[model samples]
Target: MLNRKIQPASYDINEINFITPTIHQFKNNIPLYIFEGGDEEIIKIDFLFDAGNYYSDKFLIPVITNAMLREGAGDYNSEQIAEILEFYGASVRLTTNRDIAIAGLTFLSKHYEKILPVFEKIIKEPNFPEKELKIELNNRKQDFLIENKKTRFVAQKKFLELLFGKTHPYGNYAELSDFDEITNEQLKNFFKNNYNSKSCKIFIAGKFNSEVLKFIEKLFGDSLWGLNTEKNIIKFPIQSDINKIHTEKWDGSVQSSVRIGTLCFNRLHPDYYKFQFINVLLGGYFGSRLMKNIRENKGYTYGIYSSLVSFLNGGYFMIGSEIGSQYCNDAIDEIKKEIANLYMLDTNNDEIKMVKNYMIGQIMRSFDGMLNTSETYQTIIPYSLNEKYFY
Candidate 1:
């Protein structure tokens, strides 16, 4: 019997053991990282490619190419792909960002033999059918139009454009005309150039067997496919917008979205961890100073947050919120006051202890389970950092 009134003992977490992935190489030299642990007979496999927007000459080429990969590959159409995954109780997710593109699949470990071949075809022999390309582009254009209407979306987009200049790949945004202008030929060409064995890494997590590993190697590692050439590295200069302030007014709007930030250092910077700690104390959590000042004290907005966004090329520190139009000026003034207070006031040891405990708890949660630890590893893979980064 347990006493409901008595509290559990709390001890300082001095160390955490992380489940590191076992590294292997496919026949064609593709890297495979497997995190094997857990009781459930489920597994997640992620296919990472160096095919990202940085490699595209046009605005929508990389994203469109990524979408079309699973649309129609080999003899499987989009419907067939969906049907197969559904029949096996599996799921697939495709995503593209500025630095990398990923195709992730999750299913029962028993189903790996049936599903791996389907995904293999999707990655190796994508046939960018014109009809599927048009459908995807049209749907994306609709989403673009809808998102542009929201103040927060507009502010975020403009903020990136200001930080990285329009000419740089990170800053460039897609226009409506870009959707119409992008053709199947362009997507096909981009896919052929970037989605190759040479530019690929495979990550598998959860419970799987030795037979499963050999089967994966048989499917993906058997041969060099696509262009089979080394990735071409390209560099672009960062030309930041010189202006200190930028504003775009929207007619008949009841709210004003504010974004205050400047470019900062990447995760590899010596001060990265320290800067992240300070950010959480300021606005990264519910008990942060910004929330305490603006939301609880002034009743200005529901929530406000500050975050340090790190990218392959660069990073930035941003504070953002959408406040009532009438309170915008007062809210901005309050935000600046909070920033100044960080420097003017002395933080008590109690507050410091609280923050340290909060951050440590969050880190522990990230490594609580094998699947979670693997997902956390995904965040660091782009930076080429090892598990030691957590420590």
Candidate 2:
């Protein structure tokens, strides 16, 4: 113990094993994954549904529908629901992304029974009251207006529209008119079709016992609910923009946001992880080539990043930064130069080793706690992959 000069032995990250949760099915065939481990009595439950934008035929319907679920439900109004959750020291989160929507609740295990019934009302019996819907839409419209003024927001939005055509579910964005045009009937219809018990998956993490399991089964799995409509398998072909380059000018802006990217493969592709490893060498981390060249060496901006983003239908490789308007051209040229360097020059062993160590640490961080491990598994569930993907 006193020999401080000698270093401790190190093991490869590949030697680490991820704990797989015990998978069970509720009576209605809803998948329940339980990861039970924690010193505290807190528990987290996530209900994932196929009710994302991909399933919506209209803009803003999926997200607005998901958000409005909590505004008013069965016997309780929004304020009553809020008061109940606060009294029980519970937190609720409802969000929709491109491919899925999630309703998450976190609270102490002692309050589980009391809070779950309220959640059930929110999930199954939302009324989509007109007054609440009007308020939510107006607030969201204001946020959209504010975000639309920023160069970064404009660049990001256009980037997606260009990467996948403006009509594709993953690429489409909302206009202000959408707020005025959307109807409650559409929200109800989308919710009825996509949030059915059959297509939902449940994930629970932290200290939970058999009683909690039984209660969940009794409430959510005892019988089929919602419209119980079979899910539609819809596919949209990628229709990327033909133009290689385009620009938009902001009247009174001193900074320019730059986004350069191309379409890539989804996580299901065999080479996804390998390409992600290479992407890290380029810009996936702080010590990456893009950071060293663009930020530290040239002082182009405070930071720059490259990512290999995975999605349900497809993925993309993007490099983004906000820089002084004057340096925009120079920065873009430098980025291309860096890519050329990667292609023309061989990476030295030292850089490769550093990146490898960084990624290993990242993988370890992703599974640092039981809840975090559960969250990591969530990313893979949509792809029908298992915990062994970590290996």
Best by lDDT: 2
lDDT of each: 0.85, 0.87
* lDDT by residue for model 2 (236-290), tens: 8778987533344475777788888889998898899888888999999999999
Candidate 1 weakest ten by summed lDDT: 242-251
Q: Deviation in angstroms for 251 in model 1?
A: 3.0
lDDT of 1 by residue, 1-391 (tens): 9998999998877888878889999889988988999999999999898887888766588988888888888999889988999999998889988878998889999999899899888888888988888888889999999999999988887887888888787878898889889888888789888888888889999898899999998888888877976665778888887763334447788777888778899888889988888898999999999999999999888999999988788888888988877888888888888888888656888777778888999988988777788778877887899888877
What TM value does model 2 have? 0.95
- Candidate 1 Cα misplacement greater than 4 A, ranges: 1-7, 244-249
C-alpha TM-score for every candidate: 0.95, 0.95
Name the lDDT value of residue 310 in candidate 2: 86
C-alpha displacement of 203 in model 2, angstroms? Answer: 0.2
